[model samples]
Target: MKWAIAMVDGILNVLKPSGMTSHDVIGYLRRVLQTKKIGHSGTLDPDAAGVLPVFIGAATRLLEYSGEETKSYRVELRFGVKTDTADDSGNVIETSVVFRPEQEKLVAVLKKFTGPMMQIPPMYSAVRHEGKKLYQLARAGITIERESRPITIYKLDLVYQADDYLVLDIECSKGTFIRTLCEDIAESLGMCGTVSFLLRTRSGKFVLNDAKTLEEISKAPFDHILPIEGAVEHFPELMLTDKQALRISQGVVTSISGVAEGKYRLKTASGLFIGIGSANNGMVKADKVINPFTQM
Candidate 1:
């Protein structure tokens, strides 16, 4: 039986579908789970689809620590057009003037993007300026000056190339604009383009293959909320005695000197996930103690 309450709170791996905004999933989960403490790791465009990690209850707080986690994507580019939206959902503003490249040239182009580079965020993005979304101004047919940010592209492989469409798998940092990437790739081949399709294959270490979609969630609500410790598995693990756990749970910081300095998991003798905490000067401390959830 599904419990009305969680035993512990962390993150939920959601396979977001096209046509629904990140806010839509959060809103739905908030009501379904009946909790105000909910948040998501990243936003997938309304036209794009794939992995969106939703943090629930105490897990929402984990974002502060997991902000630097990298992501991966699979994108399809149609190399004969351009759009204001930088995606296929926008108006076709321009057509190609250059001939399509051979498969070998496309592979070489993909290789160029597999490292650090600069990317300008799309106008149809949630980036805010003067207290308004950039997309708001874009919808009004207005253009604004946006700066290009540095991003790391760990991997870029050409999955396939169709008649006019190119498919690729890329591992990049957060905040990377895939639209800009496809456009740049097109430019490298002496053409104009936009993203025809995009699906996030991975986020940090979470893969879409391991995710549960909103449609599945709606049909069969799940109470399998992972513990907060699960979210910070990438961090170092630290064991604390029951006495130390109690002290930390009551908002007390216990000092365990002669250890490495960094964030670590605070677990009890019985292996109960207390929460996440940082350590320095050999003294470990709890920054946020994930309270044990009650059974309903």
Candidate 2:
């Protein structure tokens, strides 16, 4: 499919696979889409699978890689044991004090995690310590004392439950680890547990339903990518005329008339997304520019 020149520049969202790192997904996209300018907004553990937002072309410029946004996951918890990694891949370290509880009891126990709390990042994680990876230390049979950071767990819903297992749909701020949450739940229940499965159900507005698998993406004839402008559709906009679109694309802050006192999503007369802009007193400036259109 032929695309407009502005649209040909990078920005894409790829659904990552379980065995691949975020960087791996970019590499695959680079080969499939034939562009070296690919990047991702977040990191997904190699064992975890689900929606991973990928950026292509100019969209790679937008990656901040900061854990500032809320993240969501659908995960499965295996009760009756805890692992060194707190997931199925690690060595068993502790066993449950009691076998799995009844369904109602499991739901009740999970409710406590639905608010703000301190989370001590796992030793087998990507977190750095003394210029080294935590996982490196963990693999070396070394454990160091670490500080717990505050994180918010907005929602933790029980999707399904077995006699000794629970499947959860979680919405939390960035940096939350499903395995850790499972471990915390087991501790709260006076038992031990680990995560057998984890999948990111969402990343910002990117959802699993809209995600494409590697196999699917690899075979697809054309790049089914959402334009860079499509990534930040949540932001507000201010519509501009042809002249204004040109000026904004050139990095010239143009006066957007008739806008007052708030942030808006910016778009051109031809419906090309310009960027997010804020206005006060009929004057507007970009809050963040995602895509600049070709106009003269």
Which candidate leads in TM-score?
1
Error of 2 at 191 (Å): 1.0
What value of lDDT does candidate 1 attain over all alpha carbons? Answer: 0.80
What's the lDDT for all of these models?
A: 0.80, 0.76
lDDT of 1 by residue, 1-296 (tens): 23345434667788888888899888888767767778887788998889888887678777877656788899998888999888988999899765668878877888888899888888999989899899999999888999989998898888887777788888888788888888998989889989988999888767889888776776755554555665677787788777777877776767876768888878876788878877888766788777642221
lDDT of 2 by residue, 103-141 (tens): 677678778788999999999898899999899999999
Clash number for each model: 1, 11
Q: Tell me the lDDT of model 2 at 42.
A: 71
Question: Which ranges of candidate 2 are over 4 A from the true structure?
Answer: 1-7, 10-12, 65-69, 102-105, 241-247, 253-264, 276-284, 287-290, 293-296
Error of 2 at 79 (Å): 1.2
